[model samples]
Target: MSEQYPPPPGWSPPTRPPATQPYAAAPAAHPQQRPRQQPPAAAHKPGAIPLRPLTLGDMYDAAFKIIRFNPRATVGSAVLVAAIAMAIPVLATAALGAALDLSLATELTSGSGGESVTTSVDGADIAGIVGVFGSLALGSVLQGIGLILVGGMIAHVVAAASIGQKLSLGQAWAATRGKRWRLIGLTFLLGLTTAVLLVLYALSWVVVVMTTSGWQVPVVYGLISVPLFAAFFVWFWVRVYYLPVPALMLEPIGVFGALGRAFHLTRTAFWRTFGIALLTFVVAQIAGSMLSLPISFVSQAVLLGGVPGEAGVFVLVMGQAIASVVTAAFVAPFTTSVATLQYVDLRMRAEAFDVVLMQRAGLTTSGGNPRP
Candidate 1:
């Protein structure tokens, strides 16, 4: 105190005495105060399909939205596939017709006897008929394969769109590369099952007719079996209506596993799934018919305008092919998108898939924190 030295160079002492001002206390934060929490950033953007739960309308809208989101991969792929499918069948039929015509002309020009002409015509007709059917069957199989491929591609696009990602045709195809064979196998299995069921039903009717006599017996058998068959059909359809294609593409499951998974997911939600699927089918069919009706009408008019027989046939075939292509381009994507989004909806309702989707979408941070 005796040395109360002056402040160091360039530093001055307080102008007033320390005791002249009372000590002020620091303000305290209220104990109950909380750091304000900002509302969560949305997981999806407006006008985009959400990854969470969806309504039927949401499913429908999402379907079309996804088609709009990537028409190149969805509608473009469908058009390409449908054109190839229709073209193969049309060309094969044309070739067979040409061959048949050539054989008929050859027989006529050779001035063969009636018997020879009859025999030659019969043989050629049978061969031509078989060839036509064979070509048709082969074309159908290829078309089925193409449809499966398109479905798989649509599934991939819809899935990526869920996570705010866009997929080109090549990218979607790449994503589904591994599942292509599985999809084809699944389709074959489904068709085989349907054929077996039809055969069994037909056999049952035959047995009823052969083993019993009178209208009453057949009528009673039909009455008894009809409801049972319908029930069985509904059960089978509800259980397997949603194919494993979406599951195979989106999940890590194999073909059989995806089938089992589909069954499991629809077990409790059978009616819901059935209703939605039925509605979607009806809507798609109606839309497709509307799109193709004009083309069909124009073709019919052209045919009625006195075009040559062969030319009229060609015009009709070409017209139908074009209609098929257009209808397929618009309708196929809607169906696939509905299936895909419905699959997601089922998974979310049954398995909390929204959480996983959110995580994938980066809406949540690591350790379960919502992003600020």
Candidate 2:
């Protein structure tokens, strides 16, 4: 303390602070930060398809899924329908074949002393032919009716499946209960219209033939007009008429209403609809052909090769019928699904039907998560 005095002219003492202040104030206590929240998971796929506008691949995949999920409703119904449809024709053919055995055999004399025999058409043969044709027509009508019913059932199944509800065959049939006659009527109307068009087409060909001078002119005209008309027909049919079946099956509307709806739906997306339909048809055709071609060949080899005459023919016909049944069983449901999905896709695009589907599926709520 005594020596604390400045020893030199410029010397100064060190300064000291009060002891109250800590060496370093504690780091300002940071308020704890809460964890950040993550967004909810993507929309849950409840059934065969996601609740959104579907791509072609999605439609195709979902079609098979629908068939797989509701086999009794889809594939089983298809099998039953196809079997019944085929049965009518088969029974008719069998019955008619036995009943209408052509007895009009004519014996001809030949210079080589070898007897030549030929069949001459008489009134009984004509009656038999008419009966056979009538039976065939009846079978065709029944097949058409069965197809319509099956399509309606498939539509019901598709509707249920879109909402994650799997339907049984009974449920599907019940859903399509009141629509059967309407569907058949629609089909008949459509068929009648088609027949009229075909008649017109034939009449047009007759006109061309009558108007043209020679075979070459008619041939050239046919070569040109046939393809053009065929192309136009295919295009028009795909764009306009192809979707009416699904429309009639799914909606509460009648045949004309369905036709109008389909026309409207395809108006905006012709190429897309056309592409999906064409591709689906091509795939179904290829698959059916692949399955049936082998059967046909094998049946011919087994039935015709060993058996003789009418027996062989009968066996071959039966075999072919069975093949058709199997092919229809596998192919029908798939085609039906694709068609229904097309209707759905079109509705979703045009009507925001996906949101309705999601809501029905319980995949959406006001909150971030789905409602419990």
Candidate 3:
């Protein structure tokens, strides 16, 4: 039997209709002319994550299980996430440029006598300002939508993969079909707001750089503000960490309610929650370093070996993106996996999941059999 594992604490059980294991009957086949040999029973394994209960290792195990069920999707998801995370700075630049161009826009490009301001498009200033700001806001919103869409997809894939079953791209898509857009919207709301706040934080840095003299001013500003920024980040993160995504995927919940639920669920377990999350992040970093070492060696070796037309800018960018994905992919699968694990862990810890696991594992329960 697989090892027995306990879920985390304070979560409510998924409310999936309680019953025996869901086993679909295979279709009957005709007596073939010369029927193929019957496959071994072991070949007919069930579930994606296997029948074992949850465990601390499940987070790491998810990284493997995702590869096992649908290697391609897992890889694809990795590429997608890596690309997005790497492109964050570029996106941030675009957002900031657009926002400034809108907010500080002028009718003419320059002043009359002393300045070089000039313009041709009449009434275009206001429109241009609106257009620029609109684009910035839209970009932020779109980024959020993209992430949430990807997050939900990743979540479904990881959840399905965890159970030791093969879910087709179609199956994975279908599992989230009904609520993909909703998830996207919810994510967008969260992301968009966060982006706005972050922009505010970043602008404070730029202001210090521009207004202050020499490097000392900027250094002083950074030193003083770093702790402030760090504190705010942690405070905000704790409130929203688990609430929105789960609320997006599971029950209907708003910003406040979802935050409340997350706070409630995480009560007295913040350190554990933060620890697992940190561990997941650390593993991804270590895995990324390991994966990128090969890429770096090859890239450098090619350059040193007198390879022609090597290290092209585009190639470098592409390679970097790929490298980033390689490292981050190690984390993405586990990211969603932890969400599910945390959910189930909370439920089991709170709702007698230990007993359920024992029953499911065929152990002799206190009541002779585990309650359904």
For all candidates in order, the CA lDDT equals 0.78, 0.76, 0.58
Candidate 1 differs from the real structure by a C-alpha RMSD in angstroms, to one decimal, of 13.3
TM-score for each of the candidates? 0.79, 0.76, 0.54
Candidate 3 has an lDDT of 0.58
Estimate the lDDT of model 2: 0.76
What are the clash counts of all predictions, listed in order?
A: 0, 0, 18
Ranking by TM-score: 1, 2, 3
Name the regions of candidate 3 deviating beyond 4 angstroms: 1-55, 69-73, 76-148, 158-166, 201-225, 252-260, 300-311, 351-372
Task: Output the worst ten-in-a-row residue range by lDDT, candidate 2.
Answer: 102-111
RMSD of each: 13.3, 11.3, 18.7
- Reference-based lDDT, residue 202, model 3: 92
Give the winner by lDDT: 1 or 3.
1
Instruction: Give the alpha carbon lDDT tens digit for every residue of 1-372 in model 3.
Output: 899678788867665543574754444776674458766332111344333345567555655666665765655655665566556534443444443432233345656577877554445435544554454455444444455565666666654544344566566657676777666566666677789889998999888888887999888888989999887776566556654566456546555565577777667567677777677667767877898878777666655675333123223334554565565565555566667666555645566644444444444356746335
* CA deviation > 4 Å runs, candidate 2: 1-41, 92-137, 214-228, 306-310, 365-372
Clashes in candidate 3: how many?
A: 18
lDDT preference between candidates 1 and 2, better one:
1
